[model samples]
Target chain A: MRIRERIIETGLFFSALSSVFITLGIVIILTYESFGFFKEVAIVEFFTGTTWMPLFAEPKFGILPLVSGTLLTTAIALVVALPLGLISAIYLSEYAPHRLREMIKPVLELLAAVPTVVYGYFALFFLTPFLQNFLPELSGFNAISPGIIMGIMIVPYVSSVSEDAMKAVPMYIREGSYAMGATKFQTAFKVVIPAAFSGIAAAFIMGISRAIGETMVVAIAAGMMPNFTFNPMEPVQTLTSYIVQVSLGDVPHGTIEYRTIFAAGMTLFLMTLFFNIIGFWLRKRIREAY
Target chain B: MTRSAIELKAEAKNLNFYYGPVHALKNINMPIERRKVTALIGPSGCGKTTFLRCFNRMHDLYPHNRYEGEIILYPDKINIISPEIDPIEIRMQISMVFQKPNPFPKSIYENVAYGLRVRGISRKGILDEAVEKSLRGAALWEEVKGRLNSLAVDLSGGQQQRLCIARALATGPRILLFDEPTSALDPTATSKIEELIIELKNEVTIIIVTHNMQQAARVSDYTAFMYLGEIIEFDKTDKIFTAPSNRLTEEYITGRFG
Candidate 1:
């Protein structure tokens, strides 16, 4: 019995330790490889320059176009996800019948479980054509289609977390609102949402992080040209998409072009890290509040 | 004993409540007098809170919860618990303070302004006047007047409860329901709430459910002792406290058994 217990404890310890070590390893490698790239390309120019034709004869290495693409897609995704997620959360938390909520939540989450690569294809082939019927100027491969699809892909992350936050608001607070004659909509918007603000804010940040780090959908649907424009009608390449594009090509391992992926990976890592920190802080604050 | 006829605010007639298969309140009948305090006192799970919530149709918020009779509001004569009557309409007239200080995680001003906002009262001058008046009514104006923009949760437990009372009063509700409003407070906070309750009954009709017998005696004009989902006795507060009533009421009052 003692030996079995020891074995179980050891297995659990290693399981937890392995995740920490893996994360540490990723960070170490990112910093080391990025260091090599920064030595070859001026760090300031890589960050601030507008052009990004790393493989062209001229080889400009500005990251802004990729950053803007990531930002543009992320902003568009938020436009779709924030309202859709919060409204659905309110419905699930306040209005939907218990059995119905139970049935719908898992089905809604199954949206997240759908392979994101499939979403990429859907965005490219289906959504782009469907959008073009109305938006005559839209390109065959544009950020708008992929950005909207990415938004739909992340609705579950935002809605599920937000619903849990709103639900975690004590029933008594809701009763107070009802007792004052506030309708369900008023109570949800004016009282429950505000009460659960920290958790809801954290949920928004989680959704943002997921949108920023998403690779497959944008890689496949958002045309791989690194264009430095805000107009979603034009094709653009996100940092993740740039990395994917280069990784697919047979760039020699130690070349400056290959090292650019690591540099881009580090920037992506930092952007996500910034939002995750905010999410973590907001969650921590809420823990103290309740 | 002879007594004057009292003007009634509302009454529950043959009210039976069920939580799924469990009969929580059975055949309850009671009168809530205009601008007076009616206290419900009983042991835990005796359905005191359930009875208080029924006045505002709070039972409707949950699934498998049913009310079989009527809680008729005065002047309007609307059956508060009727399925045909919207609970929101009943709630607009009747407000509640809870067992714990459940403020809306908003500023003190917003907390008081919430009921009015629900009624679509948004002009700044009107909101300011109403907020001040309601805060004064709840006896919290002097302390919170300086910092109306601060969060209600930042207030002390007792102050938060008063803020809730102020929120309830802001819309000039016809009746106020308090469900063990001081159960989570310390003794000093409890007395402040008790004093506020005494002062509040001069305006809106008040119904409070309390576990403490002495609280009912101190603050209520009328008291009902409930046992096992039934009102064992209902009379003047002094009469219920000092005189003979049902055997169970007396036993519970005397702490012989719940």
Candidate 2:
């Protein structure tokens, strides 16, 4: 019996260790390549310079266009997502009857389960053309269509998380609000939403991170122009899309161009880490407020 | 004074409630008097809570819960069962406090001011006066006045419960319901809440559901003994404790059976 327990404990230990090992491996690889890239190209020029002419005779390694593109897409996706997601969450958690909630919650979950690649294909083939007819200036592969589709894909995440947060609010709080003669909408908006704000904020940050890290949809629907434009109607290349573009092309191994992908990957990693930290801090502050 | 002078503030006539096919409350007929505390005492699942919840239409908040017969609020001539009566409006006249202290995640002052703010009272002086008055009414003003800006959850359990009372009082309801309000509290907090309920009887008609027979005897002017969704006996508090009319009320008061 002791030997069996020891074996089970050892298995559990190794499983936990493997996760730490994988994270350490990613950090090491990102830092090593990032260090090598910075050695060749000045860190200041890489961060501040606007142009990214990597294949030219004299490569100008400016990463701002890629960062700006990522930010623009993320902003567009959030603008499309936040209000709709919150309202749907409120409907699901507060308004929907038990039978309807049982039916609708699973359908929303299924949306999250759909492959990101399928969303990419749908955005490219169906949505983009549908939009081009109305907006004649729309490009074949613009950020607008893909960002909107990506926003739709992310809606389930925000809604589900926010619903859980709203549901976790104590029943007595809603009762107290109702006892004061507040309507259902008022109770949900003023009392429940404020109480669940921290959790909803965390959900928003997670959705933003998902938008930033998404690759397939942006790669297929948003063209690899790497332009420093903020307009969603124009083609742009995000960090994830740039990585995909570089990996698909014939770039020599251990070259500066190849290392630049790792640099971009490092930037993505840091950006998400920054968002997670802020999200965690907000959650902590709200919890402490209670 | 004659029976006519004793106004029937609220009357439930042959009221029945069902959860799906299960009968939760059956043929409950009771008359609540004005400016008095009526204590409903029973075991868990005896339907005291369900009956109390029906007063404010809180039962409608759940799905598959249905009610039969009528609950009438006198003077207003409002049959709460009527479709024209808004549930929110009914709740404004009848407020409730739960067994657990549920202060909103806000400052002590804000918790009291929430109901007033909902009513569109925006002036700082009005809110400040209302908060102070409500807190004082709940017997919480002296303890919480200095730290009114502190989060309510930071208070002790007893203080938080008083803060909840203050919050309910801020709405200025005609009736107040307590569903085992002292059940989750410590002995000292229980006494404090009991004292506050007795004090509040002059301003609002109070209905309390309690498992503690001694608490019911101490705080109420009238006592209702319930069993299996029916009121077995109801009389003056002194008479119910000393000389109950029904054998079931006697058995329950003497700890013979729940």
Candidate 3:
């Protein structure tokens, strides 16, 4: 029995260690490639410079445009998703009849199953033209279309997580609030939402990270030029798309452009890491004993 | 029995509650007097809590498969079970303290003030006054006053129960329903809650579900003994305790059977 227990303990230890090793491996690769790029590019210039035309004859390595593009699309996506997803989550968890909730939840999750490429094509082929009529500033391939599609893609994550958090709250608490003569809306918003604050906050932050990390949808529809403008109508190239564009071309494996994309990958990784840290902190620090 | 002009705060007549197809409460008929404490005592699964919950229509949260009953609330005399009557509005006038002390993961001040906040009472001075009054009413003011901003979960179990009571009272509810509020507390905390219930009878009509016979005898003006989803006997506390008209009530109160 003791030998069997020791074997099980060793297996669990390796399982935990594997994740740490994988993370260290990715960080090492990112640091190695990005370190090589930094030798040619100044840190200040990478952060402050506006253009990101690494393929040009006079290669400009300012990463701000790509960062801004990533921020813009992610912000738009979060703006579209956070409230819509949270409200749907509340409705599904708190208001919907149990049978209806069961029926609708899987269907809402079905949105996540659609390939990101399909969402990209749909944004490029269908929504961009449709939106162009209303907002004539919209181009054939713009951040707005993909931002909206990415928001649609991420609704399931926000709703599922937020709904789970809200549901995790003890039912009697909501009942207590309702017993005080609070309307369903008031109980949901004021009581359940506040009780589930950490969970909902974490879900929202994860949504931001997911939106920032989303690739194919933005790559297909958000254009190729890394424009720094906030105008949703203007085309913008996010970090993920830039990496995709560079990798698709014949930039030699050891070339500066090849090294440049890794720097961009490192930046995306850092931003996602930062968001996740904040989310983890919130979830961990919650004073919810009940 | 000089009860010609006594006003009733709430009344339930031929009320039946169902959980899907299972009848949880069968034909409950009772009248709640204003400014009085009524205690419902019964064995587990005898529908004591279900009857107390019907006062505020708590089952309305899951309206899909809950109840079939007419709980006629006095003053308005509105049929609380009717589809047209908003349970939201009914809940505002009636508040409940649960068996387990379920305080929100918030500060003591916020926990007590949430009910007032829900009613759109945003004035700081008013909320402060109301929170203080309610906490004091629940007998938790002196203990919690020094650090009202502290998270309520930091409090002891007894204090959490009082905080829940204060939360219920903060709404200035005309009627307060308690479903075994003291069942989770220590004996000392239980007595404190019992004393608070006696004091609260001056302001609000209260219906309590308790397994503790001594608690009911001490706190309640009226005692109801229930069995199998029906009230076998309900009478003045002394009469129910000393000489219950029903054999089951006498047997149960005498510790012969539950």
Each candidate structure's count of clashing pairs: 0, 0, 2
**C-alpha TM-score for every candidate:** 0.96, 0.95, 0.92
Which is better, 1 or 2, measured by lDDT? 1
Output the worst ten-in-a-row residue range by lDDT, candidate 3 chain A. A281-290
| lDDT ranking, best first | 1, 3, 2
Per lDDT, the best of the predicted structures is 1
Q: iRMS for all predictions? A: 1.3, 1.5, 1.4
Residue pairs that clash (backbone atoms under 3 angstroms), model 1? none
* Candidate 3 TM-score, true structure as reference: 0.92
| Candidate 3 residue runs with Cα over 4 Å from true position | A1-17, A286-290, B1-7, B64-84
> What is the per-residue lDDT of model 1 for residues A25-85, given as tens digits with 9 covering 90 to 100?
9999999999999999999999999999999878999999999999999999899999999
Q: Point out the higher-scoring one by lDDT: 2 or 3.
A: 3
- Which of the predicted structures, 2 or 3, would earn the higher TM-score when compared with the native? 2
What DockQ does candidate 3 have relative to the true complex? 0.71
RMSD of each: 1.7, 2.0, 2.6
**Per-residue lDDT for B114-221 in model 1, tens only?**
989989999999999999999999999999999999888899999999999999999998999999999899999999999999998888899999989999999999
**Model 2 agreement with the true structure over B130-196: per-residue lDDT tens digits:** 9999999999999988899988889998898888899989889888999999888999999999999
True contacts kept of each: 0.82, 0.61, 0.82
